[model samples]
Target: MTTPTLPENGEHLLARATAILAKGSQIEIRNLVRSLYPAEAAFVLEALEPEPRASLWRLIPPGVMGEVLIELNVEVATALLAITDRKDLMAATEQMGADGMVDLLHVLPEPLLSQVMESIGVHNRNRFEQALSYREHTAGGLMSQDVLTIRADVTLDVVSRYLRLRGRVPAGTDSLIVVDRKDSFQGVLAISQLLTHDPHTKVSELMDTKSPGISYKTPSRDVAALFERRKLLSVPVLADDGKVLGRITIDDILDVIREEADHSLMSMAGLTEEHDMFAPVVASAKRRALWLGVNLLTAFLAAWVIDLFEDTIQQIVVLAVLMPIVASMGGIAGSQTLTLVVRGLALGQISGGNARGLLFKEISVGLLNGLIWAVVVAAVAGVWFHNPHIGILLGAAMLINLVCAAFSGVAIPVLLQKIGVDPALAGGVLLTTVTDVVGFMTFLGLATLFLL
Candidate 1:
């Protein structure tokens, strides 16, 4: 096939491909899509609506199908997999790396997954089963079995000859793993050292023993942090007995980091990173309805609290006007603290030892901010409503609510984390509820006591 002219910008390529797809020109779409790299092709597919996405997916060449599937979001990949022929699926997955295959298997239904597993060669089947043994969010699951390892006793000359015989190394082979006779964890030999050191130097003389191997059971988030902190190109995953399981490369860690960031951002809004942007209306609505229902319940709780002070609201009409100010201010303040605590928790920065200190710090910050904004709001309310008493009450309510907001912000995440709930997923909703209820109750309760 002749090379087609490529678009300079990704967006331009997507737009052009989309326009071509709109015209239902199959051959042109196929040529345009097949010309792009697998990742670029996946991008185009993801950018299209469901029907068009399916059309574009059908145009992708079989040779690069596996790579494109690897790049697509889980939801989109799973959808495509459901429609693909079993033979085609087997062909696409035949050459996939162990890590990629494991990822694919995760989204496949058990029956189809069994069929695909049965189709692979014995060696590959063993490798896939080993990788599948670990949890998907663990180091073993994130690692690839395609690692180059060297014996510690081998000299640089021997290493060079071996590399020459092998002809190529893995894609991210910045270093060669050095293992003992029993295939146990030892260390790594940097490629630079092999290239520059004396040919007579033994692998043990140059291997880095200080850099640690990650346990296969380590969480993927912790693995990503390790990679980031060490500036690692690759690290070995090892069993409890120090047997090398596999090696996680920078590319895999990058995927983990990205997935994590997406998870955090989406979880804040009660959504998943895997949520397809172009999902069908009913399906999307059904998924969203759960969170909306959760929010509605929280809204009702706040309304119930307001109902308790209904007489106060009726007697003091200004309380109704100034009430939102109290709740809104507290909500914003609590969110600021909540976001920080959740992030700190995710990074492993916040712990039991420092949590108390952090809590006090946040409370102090809330107090200072409450004093500042409270005075400002109090003065404005006094002048606007011509009542210093109402102004004083609003300011007191503001100060109390802000302080309560800060406390809840820190406490909510820590408590949720302890109870095995994801702080990022549940913390915001809980924090919002706390601030709203506290703000409403404090403002309205004070009104009921004094104004009534």
Candidate 2:
């Protein structure tokens, strides 16, 4: 199927939003979101100034805010919600689907919990509130309340008739769920199953109960794994009571991935996935600075190795300039390995048992790449610096750095997991720091021995 076309605001929309927000002109910003398509409206809402974003957020309808909130980063959503009224907050909450509400409630603190709960429709409030009791990372917290449930004893004609009402559910519905009169989950019947089945058959006769579905207490990431593994479009969410609470659609699972992915990507680059544009530059800088400071500490350790080679550097000025290249190459090479491992681990493709095999593959890749690249750099250093000994130094250091880089890059994530750290949270910084320090130390340490 062809993908729907997203708005092409592209380059200049941000420029325009900046201009509008800078004027403190609420009307212009409000008009921007109003004028755009729902997706575009969301984008515009996101780009509006923080001051105006909060002030003007209330001006937009709650439905619009809910739609836009899903598109906005959690940090930004938190900020916007902070200034919004309980009614508006609840309106947004009620407008959101089960999985979306799960995400919102997960982040929304306890004090505001009661207010937000009060706003959700009474029927759904119990289901959503039930999900809230599950552990944070579990399936229940990520499941949607937008399931279609039918009594198992209902006749095929009756089931088909009920399934025909797919689009009518309050939270927005698609899939059909089957349950006994006691509300215990029986099986799941897709919407298509209803139309295809004979009208006289019972729901219990028509539904597919044996299909695999995760319980609500499994971690959200594991829930994602089930979708990929089973190739399902939607999975049912069950209460502790075994009643069908909702179904977590693929879109909801995809959102979990997207959010986690955003966290990984932004955190990797030393940026926090925050929503507040109004936060002082210093605050943003401070967040970056902590990681930068960590990187700086590692860089200094690299420099300390150079300090040990001051004599060699003074004798051959070219070694000083050329060393960074060797280290930088290793850093880049290490990052490539790091990305692959991190993604594999996150996706469940590489688990604890297979991680060793992955390590072997990454290390081999690093070694082969180092050998090829080392030859190029060593040859260049030999000609550029007019010294055969320096060439040998470069070759040896490149090989060492690459090997070390590979080991460190793969190992850090694995180690973090072993210790119960969210490896994605700080893996990039730690991995980069490892490669950087090792590269510098090896490059300069080799130079000191061979060149001097």
Candidate 3:
């Protein structure tokens, strides 16, 4: 199929492809799929429903299919892989790098995985196995075995000749990894040093030893942070015994950073970054039901708290009307603090050393905000109901709830993290519960003691 004119953007491409597919123009769809880059093709496929996605998947060239699969989210990729022909799967992976192959292996079933593994050459099979040994979210799994290594004792002239003979270096090869004869980590030699330095200079004489190799077991998030802090294009990944394993490039780190950002954003809504937007209705509902149930339970807890003070609410009906305001203000204030602390923890800015200070600061801010809003809310309540006592009780409840919300906001995330729960996923629900219960209890309990 010949390439057609590229669409302006992903939406346009999806629109054009949908129109073509509706017309039953298989050849046109093939050309359309082939015209865009792998990422763009993956985007269009993801945007389509299952039928159209499978249709477009069939049209993708085997050479590009591997890359498109690599670009897809885990759920979508796994679904596509399940129906794919074994021969087609082999063709798709034939030209893939170790890293790309590892990605496919993650979603492939045991039978298909074994077939694919057996199909690759021994050298590549070893590399793929080595990569598979590391957790998908760690440095080793994200690294590529296509690193260029040189002995530290080599001369600049020798390195230059080596590069010329090799014809091409790996993509993102900003520096040559320096290792000893036994492949122990030494340092890195920037490409600039090779071109500008005298030929007589030894690699060790010009190599930078300050930047250390990242351990293969290091978390991908921490690796991304290191890259951001050091402004690195690439870094060496080393085995536990300091043997060179592979190297992770900026592109890999960029993917990690993007996934992390997506994770944080999605988790706030009780979803995963890998969630399929077009998943089956039943599947989608099944995934969301657990969180919805959790939320319902929390809502019941808040309702139970309110039920305890039914008599006070009955005597002062205005308290029922004004109850939501107290809870809402506390929820909003706590959410603000929760967001700040979560971001700080993600960026490694908040730790044991500074967490106490941060907690005190957030509490103080909550107190100050409580005092300010309390007066405003109290004045409004007093005027609205013409009862100063009720107004004062409302204000006191607001202040108490806000303070408790602030404390819960900071403490909940830290505590959840300590127990190995994702704070982002569970923090919001827990915070809402705290604010609601505290706001209701303080407001109605005060009403019962005084106004009744």
Candidate 4:
């Protein structure tokens, strides 16, 4: 087949694919998609809704199905797999890397999982099971059993000849793993060194021994951080006894980083990163309703706080006019601090060592900002309503609420994390609640004491 001109990016590819699909020309659509890479095709599939996605999925050849399926999101992949026949699913998964297969298995039904396991043969089945043994978001689960290991005693010439005999190395193969006779990992022999160094040099002599191995149980987040900090191409996952289980490549690390970003963004809204953007209306609503209900409850709590000063609101109509400003400013301020703390926690930047320092820093920031904005808002309110007393009361309230907001923003995430709750999912609601209640109470309470 002649080479096809590739689209510039995913969006352009998607647009062209949509145009082809819109024409109802299956052959043209298939031809156009066949030329795209698995990852690109996966992106297209993700962008398309279910019905069109199914039609496109059928056009992809079986040879690339495993790769394409692996690239799609777990929910989307499972949906497609549900429609596929047992034989086809087996065929598609048979060629997948250990980590990819493990990922696919996590979403598969038990019966189908069994059948898939039966087809993978004994050696691969053990590897798959070993990988599955780890939590899905751990280093072992993210690693592939497919590795090229060489004995440390071997010379570069011997290692080079062995690789030649094997015909091809694995993708992302930057180094040959060096291990002892017992299969315990020793070090890594760089591919560059293998190609450039004296062929007679011993693997042990040339290998990089200082590079650390990731424990099989290390969290996937930590794994991604390691790859980033070390600028690693791949790292070995090791058993407690130092035996090598498999390897995690830079590709896997990239996936972890992307998922983390998605997770952080989604969790702020009390949603998971895996949520399908175009899921059925009822299903989507049902999932969202839970968070909505939580937010509603918090809203009621804030309303109750406002209700406590209901007469105050009535006594001063101006207070009713200006209540939202205090609450809104506090909410925005608290959200900023909360987001920073959450991000710091996620990156392992904040800990016991610096927690007190950070808390002091955030509160100090809040005090400074609160003073500045309180003066601004107070000036605006005093001038607008021609009431200096009201302006002074509002200013004090703003300063008080902002300081409270800063404290809550710093404290909430740390407390939630300590209690094993995800701060990202819960922090915003709590911070908003605190800010609103405190902002309203402080402003109105001051009004009650002075204006009443």
Question: How does each model score on lDDT?
Answer: 0.88, 0.73, 0.89, 0.88
Query: lDDT per residue, candidate 1, 1-452, as tens digits?
Result: 99897456878878888788878887888788767887788888888888888877776666678888878888888888877777777787877766667777777778988998899889888878877888889997788888888899989999999999999888888898899999998899999997798999999999999978999999999998888787888999899999887899998888898899999999998899998889889989998888899999999999999999888888887788888999999999999999999999998899989999999999999999999988998898999999988999999999999999999999999999999999999998999899999999999998888887
Please give, for residues 1-452, the per-residue lDDT of candidate 3 as tens digits: 99896447767777887898888787787778777888888888888899988888887878878889888998998888877877777898987766677877877778888998898889878878877889989998889888999998889999999999999999889999999878999999999998898999999899999976999999999999999999999999999889999999999998999899999999998999888899999999999999999999999999999999988778778899999999999999999999999987888888899999989998999999999999999999999999988889899999999898889889999998889999999999999999999998889898899888
Where's the lowest-lDDT run of ten residues in candidate 1? 95-104
Off by over 4 Å in 2: 1-6, 9-32, 36-39, 52-55, 66-71, 82-128, 151-153, 162-174, 239-242
lDDT of 4 by residue, 333-406 (tens): 99999999999989888899899999999999999999999899889999999999999899899999888999
**Runs in model 4 lying further than 4 Å from the true structure:** 1-7, 97-99
Ten contiguous residues with the weakest lDDT in model 4: 94-103
Better of 1 and 3 by lDDT: 3
As a TM-score, model 4 comes out at 0.95
Evaluated at residue 374, the lDDT of candidate 4 is 88
lDDT computed for candidate 2: 0.73
lDDT of 4: 0.88
| Residue 185 in candidate 4, Cα distance off native in Å | 2.2
User: Model 3 Cα displacement at 38 (Å)?
Assistant: 0.9
Q: What's the lDDT for residue 38 in model 1? A: 79
- Please report how far candidate 3 places residue 95 from its true position, in Å: 2.1
lDDT for each residue of candidate 2 in 224-320, tens digit (9 for 90 to 100):
8888888888777776788776677777778678767777877676675653555668777777778778878877787776787788779878877
